[model samples]
Target: MLVRMGKNWEISEEISKLQGKIRNLLKETGWSVKDFADKYFWEELDSDGAYGDEDDKSRHAEKVKKHLSSSSSTAKRLELLKKYVEFIETSRLYRKDVMPLRRETASGMQDAGFKAAMRKLSSELNELLLKKS
Candidate 1:
């Protein structure tokens, strides 16, 4: 029924809304994080001693990636998160008692640019489907 279809669309819309927030958060904070990493890496290298060309953003970005990546293992972070979640879920009715908080899935949140592409594709497909019918 049309009502069920609308209800189903609600989840996708929620996903889209959450995806938009994630994309914005990543866009804003990724730069801030990288900037912090870039400074830290630069300082570490400079203290240990050397100067790369001042104009090269690529060089700085690379150093940030290298150092930021080496700073923590994803496996360890995930392991900690798993234990934390288990503790929260089992030891207390944490999420059940809390007010609803919107969040994206850890692995599946997509950037809005991709969502725009998907919308474009969906529009084209809808047009084609209508013609075929």
Candidate 2:
């Protein structure tokens, strides 16, 4: 009877391990889904052109919601996650893949200051161009 109990305990331990793996896989699947949607919405879609109006934006949101609802199962999520990984591996972004802003500059200012200065200079140049026109 003790030997049989030991075997049962071992089985339960193995089942627990498998359940943990499934849980982690589900979490990873969720992250991948969000990442894919983020890239699709921000990088792939032309937001300013196609989703300019409120109606267009709502329509696109509905489409996204519908698609996500349809792919709610774990198996579907895994399949989509695999495709997302494949797509990311194949896509060629023009810019080098590097962290945009790592930390503050030596002067204790963020890169936003540099960006703001450049924007100010651009606006001044645009004003001059308008005057010349």
Root-mean-square deviation per candidate:
23.1, 14.0
lDDT of 1: 0.44
TM-score of each: 0.22, 0.26
lDDT of 1 at 32: 49
How well is each residue in 9-128 modelled by candidate 2, as lDDT tens digits? 554444444434433543544434444455555544654566555565456555544544442335444444454444443333211132121222245454877867766776686555
Backbone clashes counted, model 1: 0
lDDT for 46 in candidate 2 is 54
TM-score of 2: 0.26
Worst lDDT 10-window in candidate 2:
94-103
